[model samples]
Target: MNALSIRSIHGRQIFDSRGMPTVEAEIVLHNGVRASASVPSGASTGRFEACELRDNLAEYHGKGVSSAVNHINTPIQEALVGESCDDQWTLDNKLMVLDGTQNKSKIGANAILAVSLACAKAAAKAYGLELFRYLGGLQANTLPIPMMNILNGGAHAGNNLEIQEFMIVPVGAHSFTEAMKMGTEIYASLRNCLKKKGLSTGIGDEGGYAPDLNGDEEALSLLMEAIQLAGYQPNYDVKIALDAAANEWYKNGHYIFPKLQKKITQSELKGYWEELCQKYPIYSIEDPFAEEDFPGFSELTASLGGSVQIVGDDLFVTNPDRLRQGISSLSGNAVLIKPNQIGTLTETLSTIRLAKEHGYGVILSHRSGETEDTTIADLSVAVNAGQIKTGAPARSERVCKYNRLLKIESLISGSEYPKK
Candidate 1:
C-alpha cells in the first residue's frame, strides 16, 4: 500500500499571457516522479474572489507575484514537504489554516492554488492513475459539452462591445467528439464570415475575434450566419450563449454599453436580455448584473429560468458561501467554476458538489490569461460536469484542453456521453 512519500516542493515566479508574473509550483516524490502546475490569471476577476498576490511596486506595473513565489518556497514548502500528496484535503487544509483567512489573503490564493494543483498532479502520477480517475474514482466517465466562445468584447477584448463573451454551444450533438466537431466547424465559418465583412481577425484573450461591433445583436447575426455556413441549423445543431460579465463595465450603479453609446438600469437590462432571448437562439446568460445585484438576478431568473440558463460568474466566483447566498436569494440557476477563484482543488470540488446538490448547473471555465496546463480538462471529466467553457478553438493554450478531451474520449471507447 505504500509507494513514494512527497520529498520536496518549491515554487517560482512565471510569466502569464499578459506578460504578468504568476506563480508556478513543483512537487517531487521520493521515487523521483515530479509534477509542476501553474495557476492561470484572470483579466476580468470578481471583486469578492480570493486575492491574487501582486507587488504594488513599479515592477511589472504592480502586477508582479514575487511575494507569492517566495511564500510557496519558504513556509508553505516547509509545512508541506514529507506529507502524503494523496491527502489532498489535508494538504489543502494546511494551506487554509496557514493562510488563516476567508479568502486566503495571508498567503495568497495564487501560491496556494499552484501548490495544491501541483501536489494533485504528483500524487496521480506517483499512484499510476490518470488524473481524472485519481480525482473522480470510477464514476468519472462522462465528457462535458463544449461551450466555445467565438466572439469577445468588454474587458476581454479591445472592442467597445459591452458583452464579454459570445459563445456557440453544440448541445444537440450525441457525443463529445461530435459536439467538438460542430464547434470547430462553426469557428472556421466565423473566421471566413469576418473576412468577408472586411473585419480584422485579431483575437482577444480567449482567442475569439475582437471586432468593432455596435451592439450584441450584430454578434447574434454573425453566429447564425456562421452556423448556416457550416451546414447546421440554428438552436438545433448549435445554441448561442453570452457571458455579459456585466460587472466589468458596470459604472457607479448603471450598466453602460459604450458600443451602443447608452447606459441601462436594472429593469432595462432585464428587458434587454428578454429581447435577446426572443430574437436569437440564446441558451444561457452569465453575469447579467453586477456581483452585488442579487435582486436583479432573482427577477431575471424567475422570468427566464423556465426557458434558458442564467449563469453567475462574478456573482458566485465558485465560493461556497457566495453560492449558498445565491441559493437563498435565487440569484442564479447555474454557476461558473474557476479553481483559481477559490484557491484549491479540494475547495473547487466542494463548491462544484455544493452547486450540483442544489440542482444548479456547473460550468467549468478557463481564465482569460492562461498557461498550457491541461488539468482543468481532467477535472472537468472527473467531476462529470455536463458543461465546460474553455474559450475558442485557437491558440495552443486554449486548444490543449480540447485536445486532451479528445484523447480522453479515445481512451473510453465504449462509453456514451451526455449521461442518461
Candidate 2:
C-alpha cells in the first residue's frame, strides 16, 4: 500500500465566524499523517453558486450542517478511503462524479469541499512540503497585493447605503508587509474619523465599518480623509475599490438607491460610477451591475477597462463556464475567486488558470461568513493571483488569512509582491 494512500476520513459540524454550522473534514494517510480543513459560508451569494447543503431542522435556526457532515462521514468516506492521495484532479473528479450533480446538490458542496481540502493538506504533510509549494511547485513565490475592505453597506450591513464594500488597495507597497501597514493604518484612521463625527464605528459581516453616513459618496469622502490622515497619497500610494453588489438592489431594468432615493436606468448608473471614478482615486469596481447583466458589464469594461479594474464576483462566482462567457463578451477585466463559490480547490485553481489565460486579473477572496481556514492565502500565492480581498484587519477570521500570508512571506526565499 502506498504510504500516501488515504486511510480514513471523518467529518464533523463546526461553527463558522458567523456562528453558523459548517462542515469540517479530517483525513488520515496510511503513514499516520493527518490534516483537517473547514469550509466557509457566503452571505452575498450568487444564484449560480454550488449548493451548500444544510439540515432544515429547528437546530441552529435551520442552518445546521448535520446532513453535510453525515454525507462526508459516510458516502464520501466510502468512496475515497484507500484511494491514492497524490493526484488532486483525480480525487476532486471522483468527488464530483460521486455526487453526480452539476451543482453538487446531492452530497453538498460544503462536505465535498471539506474532504477535498483535507486531502490536499494531508498530502502536503505526507510529502513534507508547504501547501503552496505542494500545489504550485517551486514557482509559487509571488505574494498577492491585499485589497482591504474598510467600509461596508448593502446586504453585508443594516445600513441604508447601496454599496456593499469600500476597500483600500496598497498598490504602491513594495512588499506584502508594507501593504498590511498601509491598510491597517488607514483602517485605524477611518475609525477615528468616524468617532469624531459621532458615527458608529461598528463593523459589518466582513469587519468593515458600517457607519450610517449621509450617502454613498460620504463613505468615499470618509475613506479619502482616512487615507490622507494615514499619511498616504491617494491614487499614488493607495487606491480605492468597491463591491457594489448591485444585484442586491437591481429592480426591473433599473438600479435602486434607497438612501439616495433614486431609481435610475443602467446607463444612468454607469454614468454615476464613471463620475465617481473620475472624482476619486478609485482603481477597481466589482459587480458594478447585476449578475445577469453581462452586456452592462461588457459596456463598463469597454469604457473603463483601460484604467480601472472591473471585477466580477457574483457574475462569475469562480465558475469557469461563466468566466469563459465573460471573457468572450469582454464583460469584466477581473474575477473574484472564492473557493466556496466553486466548492473545491481543484476547480478553484482551474478557474484561476482560465482567468489568467484570458488576460483577466484574479482576486482570490474570502466569504463574508468565513472561517479560520487559510487555504485561500496559500492559493493566492500558489497561483500568483496578484490580488486578494480578505476583509479588514479587524476580525480574527479575516486576519488569519493575512497572518498566514505573512508567515508564507517569511518562509519564501525570494518572495515578490506584485507590481501595480
Candidate 3:
C-alpha cells in the first residue's frame, strides 16, 4: 500500500450569497482525487472567533478575499505539499503552528478552514466512505433535527426586531425527514398567515420573513399561531428556539432592545428568558447575555439550564479553553459548533469531544452569510450533533443543505429518534 501525498493546493476568491467575496480552496492528492471547500462569512460574528481575513483594499468595498486566496496558494501550499492526506490532525496542526497566532489571523481562518475541509473531503473520497463516516466513525449515522430559522431579525436582516433568529424545532417528529417536513409546512403556513394579515413576507438573510414587528413577543406569538394553523401542536409537535446573538445588541452593561425602546440588565434578561420559557414552547436560547459576561451566562444557565438549552456561541467562541472555563463556571449546557470559529476540523472536533465529555449538547451551525456549501450538513451527521441551525427552506444556498441531508438519509439506516 502506498501513501497518498498532497499534490497541489490552490485557492480563489469567490462570491457568497451577499455578493461578498470569500475564499475557496482545492486540494488534490497524488492519486488524482480532488476536493474543494468554501468558507462562509458571518454578518454577526463574535469578537473571540478566529479572524476572517479580508483584503482591505479599495476593491470590492474591502470585502475582497484575494489576500486569503494568496495565503492558500503560497504559505499554506508550501506547508502541506508533501504531507500525507489521511492524517488530518497532522496537516491541520502544521497550519496552526505555521501561523503561530491564537486566532489564525496570519493565514486567515477562512483560508485554513477551506484547506482543512477540502483535505477531509479528499480523505473521505480516497477511502470510499461517506464524509460523516470518515469524521464520525461507524456510529455517525443520525441526521440532526433541524433548528430552522423562520423569522429572521436583528443582524440577519434589515428589520426592527431585536431577537436575531426565531427558530422552529420539530421536537415531536420521529425522524429527520419528518422534522424537515414539519418545518417546511410551518414555514409555508407562516408565510400564508402573514400574507392574509397584509404583512410583508419579505425575507431576511437566513430566509426568514422580516416583517417589522412590535417586539420579540410578537415573533413568538405568530410562530405559535402558525404551528396550530399548520395542524401541529405547539410544545408537543413542535417547539421554538432563539439565537438572540446578544452580542449584537449588548452595550455598556445593558441589553438594548431598540424596538421596545428599553434596556435590560442581566437580571432582567434572565427573568425575560424564564418568562418566555414558561409562556411558550421555547426549548433553547443562545447568547442570551453579553459575550464577556460569564457570570451572567452562569446565572441564566443556573436558573433555566434544567428546563431549556442555554447554548454558548459568542460566550465560548467554540474555543476549547473557553469551553473548559464555561464548564467549570456552569455557564451553559450546550455549545454551538461552527468550524470557522476555530479554523480547522481538528479543533472543531476537539471542541465537540470536550463538550460531550462535559455533558454539553452540540448544535452544528451555519453563518448568516452563506454559500452553496453543504459541508456543514455532512458535519452535523458526522458528529451526530443532534441539532443544526441552518436558515429557512427558501434560498438555494440554504436549501442545498436540506437537500444534502435528504440524500444522506437515503444512504443511512433508520432514525434513532423516530417520530413518537
lDDT of each: 0.90, 0.93, 0.90
Where does model 2 exceed 4 Å of error?
258-261
Order of models, best TM-score first: 2, 3, 1
Q: Whose TM-score is greatest here?
A: 2
| Model 3 lDDT tens row, 1-420 | 235789999999888888899999999888898989998989988899999998899999988999899999999999999888889999999999988999999889999999999999999998998888888888887788899999999888788898999999999987878888899999999999899888899999989999987778999999999999999999899999999988877877678886666877778888988999989988899999878888988998888888899999998888999999999999989999989899999999999999999899899998888988899999999888888888999999899999998888888876455331
The model with the greatest lDDT is 2
lDDT of 2 by residue, 1-420 (tens): 888999999999998988999989999999999999999998878999999998989989999999999999889989998898878898999999999999999999999999999999998999899999999999999999999988989888999778999999999999999999999999999999999999999999999999898888999999999999999999999999999998876777678875666888899989988999999999999999989999999999999999999999999999999999999999999999988888888999899999989999999899888899899999899999999999999999999999999999999998988888
Worst 10 contiguous positions by lDDT, candidate 2: 252-261
Q: lDDT tens digits, residues 90-191, model 1? A: 999999999999989889999999999999999999889989889988888889899998999988898877889999999789888898899999999999
TM-scores vs. true structure, each candidate: 0.97, 0.98, 0.98
**Candidate 3: Cα lDDT at 44:** 85
Quote the positional error of residue 374 for candidate 2 in Å: 0.4
- lDDT minimum window of 10 residues, candidate 3: 411-420
Name the better of 2 and 3 by lDDT: 2
lDDT for model 1, please.
Answer: 0.90
> Model 3, stretches more than 4 Å misplaced?
1-3, 259-261, 418-420
